[model samples]
Target: MTALPLTEAARGATPTSSRVAAVTRLHLARRINVLVVPLIITAVVFVVTIVIQVAIQRATAGGSTAADYAAGARLNPAIAWAQTGYFVALGVSTVASTFPLAASLGTTRRDFALGTTLAHLLTSLYLTAVFTALLGLELLTDHWFGGFYVFDVGLLGAGDPATFAATIAVSSLLCLSIGSVFGAAWLRFGPRGPLAISLATVLVLAVVLLVAVPSFDALTTAFRPWWLVVGAAALIVLSVGGTFAFLRRASVR
Candidate 1:
């Protein structure tokens, strides 16, 4: 007897289900380039910075008194941590760059936006893990580097661990929110989009800085306690909301 044609079963395959699977695969594939590579680069940068800062601290306090070493070492992590904004920017931009690729691949706008946002969230988690590991190492090694706000073995019993934990928790959320919006915008709108957003952010920040600094003549600081948190929250909310709105407004394939 003649065998049934394979084409008949193939023709009966569900298109919608296949399309969803295809979209998922495509999202994952795009994510590797947009998220993983950038996160790796950020991690590498963090390692290099840590090494350099540690070396600098060692050189400065290689033969100094314990108190002197502690003081000197403490400054390095603080400085290095400040410079971490560069890695954050890189991670965000990497995720953002994926938008154009998604669009090029004929993925729906919503999927593209959501993918970009998810990539940022993943990268933020990665960074948070790295920071935590670094902090733990510092504490374990009795490294008295003040810049990073690490636990001092001697002070571990005396100091407030809750503060450190809370700080990390807050910082991680801030990074994720900021990175998500920045990266998504870059991906969706190319270089111009990032430029516009960056410029606007800078302008607003500059104004705040100028306004706040000059007003500190009364024993008060202009740095709002919740400024970073609130700003991050706004960015995250706007990014998600705007992305969805944009997708809805646009005609997707």
Candidate 2:
């Protein structure tokens, strides 16, 4: 039999749910750029970090005091921070590229938004699992190449596997949510809009910081893991809501 058009096929399927799944599968097919690229970057950075640590250790191998070794073994968690940029790019690209295609395929804005949200969440969880496994391996292998501290740094966990994984997972969601908002803004308002939104965000953050500086210590103390959880949830809700609202009115340009 001749194949039906995507819109007709979607109508004949399970309706909303299947449409969302179809949109999700469309994005998932491009998982290499969305997921693997960032992972490769993270892995490369991790390897470089270990190499640098090993070089430092080797330089002081002979007659190196315990304090020297300890100092040399210190690892910065900057590589993990770099991974967030990839996630942000992924979010922006999804909107810039996939939105138009989905619209062309007769996908409803609600289904597209839902599908993108689901894709990002699943991607975030998958990356979290991978990072967690890497951390475990790093720990088990005593830092994966001559006692390096790439994944065992204080910023990540200092040694606690659970804390490291939880931190990565939460931060990944926040980055993904923020990026999605940025993308949606761009999609709805065009180029200037996202820039304007970004500037406004910076201004608001600056104002908040200026107002809270006097109570910085107290604020930091009050900001606990539960607060992070709440904040992440709020961001995810707002980002997804904003995306849906924007795309609902957005034209395929």
Candidate 3:
């Protein structure tokens, strides 16, 4: 088959909006496993945790078989943290793989970055919706599955349902953005760059922890919804902006 001329291929190229959408679609498609498998595992872990907790409660009841073991049951919602790692991997893999491929296919860096950001946003929103719905169902069922507290624990269960969902969504976006920033660092400066950045961040954090240990309680107390939202937005802006800046000069290797 004869290849089309460069000019002809350019003229027949996908429209700008379609190109961006395609990038987003492709990224999402490639990440479906990462997006889904973790959640399923998380749900299984939650159920298992509930079972273990119930068994312990029953054993400790001292021959009282009719004791209400489900009462006062609580389980940490740490399984949700799996979503954080998933997003981080998603960000890194998308940049490591898709960025170069898209660039080679004549897609501009701007469109690629925009599409990636859009994909992250959509993924975060979808996860948030699922989480919120599950939480609502848990509450409606009076903490289903032996009254285990999977979604209702710590700050996640502190506020009203709307506040909880908003917090989750914002935090998810922030996590995705931070992951993308790390991925971009790797893309721009290779493996050494990310290692250096990680070391610097750890050093800075250690210093802060040592110097400000006494004020940690105050900081924790002041972490209200408004402040969290503001901080998450700021981090998202910084991460996305940094990724874009890096990609503008990034070479496909």
Candidate 4:
């Protein structure tokens, strides 16, 4: 196909309001991987957690189950963290595979970036709501779903709606952003791209930790939930910015 001039491409392209949406739709083309898979994982996590909870209860049959469960809560009953690696892999694979296709289909880098962000936001919201709903059910059932704590574990906010939602949203965004940026890096600079980014990140984090060692106690004492939201927000911004920067000059086919 002959290349359209910039003016012609602009004139022929989708409207400003819809271009990002178009890119998002393009991302959603792989709905099974991008959307449905995480849900499947959630289901699996739910059943597995329930089984573990029930087993723990049965094992503690001699004592007060509640008390024993409470004592062993340190093991982190809510194994929802299973979704963490999946979300990250989702981000990486989506960006790495989708960017070229979006570009070839006439999506501007800006639109693709914005659209990816929108897609992640929607996905995060969807997952968070699903978790919140299941959590509500767990609470309503008096934590006796098959005589086990399915979602009211401490790691899952112990039944606090807002905290749980925030945790899920923040975590989803983090994993997606982290994956997207790495994918963008790979596209921009091949395999070494992610390696370089990882080394730089580790170096920076190590430096920060070393510098903050003296104030570790104070930092721990002053910890708050908002801190996570703030940190995740900052990382998301950086990830998006890095993605844009990488793609803006990329000579992808």
Candidate 5:
């Protein structure tokens, strides 16, 4: 936020709900970073995707049929995840830059955590709604007037609006929560905090791979989408709780 007006409770006994709402407002005060930029990115990605695909369609017209072009579009699933990089960077900056200012405004750690999480929820919902709507339109138009696909591809729910919304919501919060934890780590323990987290994460992943590699086939066969949902849910909780734990113990610097 350019210049956050301190909205701390006056004194006596401010309700917990009010304090939390204040924090949420503080976080969302600067909507450009969390809101506008993503929309811009969407526009840019959409336009560029269409341009490149159209160019390819023209270039390969002699050899490839419409089926081939559609198949090729589905093959490039990476585009669906491209916005993830932006979200991750946004997540880190959101908490890292705001926490000290929030504390100076007399916002308690508990309030900050709750408020920031609410902001994350709202943001994820908003962005997901945008994408879901776009997906709906893409389906309605039969893949953008037929022969183009942006949100209707498999990587982005492939015309399934419910799955699309669910996927976007979870992924958005996952990105923000994960980044916020690292941001909180930096606030709590300085530069080494994120470093430590990185090392620990790497170690855990390595150990899991080592243990699971032997039964990888069996596990893969038995695995279900719900398992991934459960894992993601756990990770989201861990990240948010980690942020709170870090902020609770560390002084705002």
Candidate 6:
């Protein structure tokens, strides 16, 4: 039998195009998993913590259990934002290290890098806002599901608003800057890059912790919202600018 002519080949291209579309959709679906998995894990952990704290409160009287004392006050809503920021920063870093799922997507490595970085920013903002709203709702209204401990520990309380906001801002900034650089390195070198970044982040954090912990009692007095806002802004500028630079270079190759 004779092979199909050019006309037949053109006709057959429709299936190939359709398949490509299907595959692209699949890739997008998988990409979403990167964000979803982290969210689910964080949610589960948060819920468990709340449950455990509530149970302990009931078991020990109005005060709290030994475990609660060891763990410090219950999860502060503001700190939750800080934690979210940190995780987004980390996730962006990690995703940057990995190659885009398919070469066929024709999305340049730079776009992939930018996309993941933006995803981090957006997800963190969404989560932080969600947490803040939840806390606000609890405070404004009398009816809530949990016990008294949730009221005492969950809310930011009076003096906590400014301080906690500062913490969230500072943490987000620091994480974003560090994560971006680490992510760039990871993209450049692959597996070994993350290990290197991890060690570096830990070392840097350790040094800061050593200094901060010692002086915290005194430093707390001087800490201000303006300082945190300024610091966070600086770090954000640096991180975003640096990442874009890295991506520009990456695109060249």
Alpha carbon lDDT of each predicted model: 0.51, 0.76, 0.74, 0.79, 0.82, 0.51
- Candidate 2, 177-246: lDDT as tens digits: 7777788888888887689878987998999999999999999888866776787788778777877888
Angstrom error of the Cα, residue 113, model 3: value is 0.7
Task: Please write out the lDDT profile of model 5 over residues 171-204, one tens digit for every residue.
Answer: 8999999998998899889999999999999999
Cα deviation at 238, candidate 1, in Å, is 3.7
TM-score of 5: 0.91
* TM-scores of all predicted structures: 0.57, 0.87, 0.82, 0.90, 0.91, 0.56
Question: What's every prediction's RMSD, in angstroms?
Answer: 8.0, 3.1, 4.3, 3.1, 2.6, 9.2
**How many clashing residue pairs are found in candidate 4?**
0
Q: Candidate 3, after superposition: displacement of residue 80 in Å?
A: 2.4
TM-score of 2: 0.87
Candidate 5 deviant stretches above 4 angstroms: 1-12, 62-65
Alpha-carbon runs more than 4 Å astray in model 1: 1-64, 78-96, 100-107, 144-191, 218-227, 239-253
Compared with the true structure, what per-residue lDDT tens digits does model 3 show for residues 1-253?
1111224366357566776787788777765454776578668877787787678766776644433443334335565675677777777777767787777666778878988899889888987888888788878887774656777655575425987788788888887788887887888888876787789879988998998788989888876758767867987998899889888877788
Which pairs of residues collide in candidate 3?
A: none
Give the winner by TM-score: 5
Candidate 4 global CA lDDT score: 0.79
Question: Total clashes, candidate 2?
Answer: 0
- Rank order (by TM-score, best first): 5, 4, 2, 3, 1, 6
Model 6 clash tally? 0
The candidates, ranked best first by lDDT, are 5, 4, 2, 3, 6, 1
Backbone clashes in candidate 3 total 0
| Candidate 5 colliding pairs, count | 0
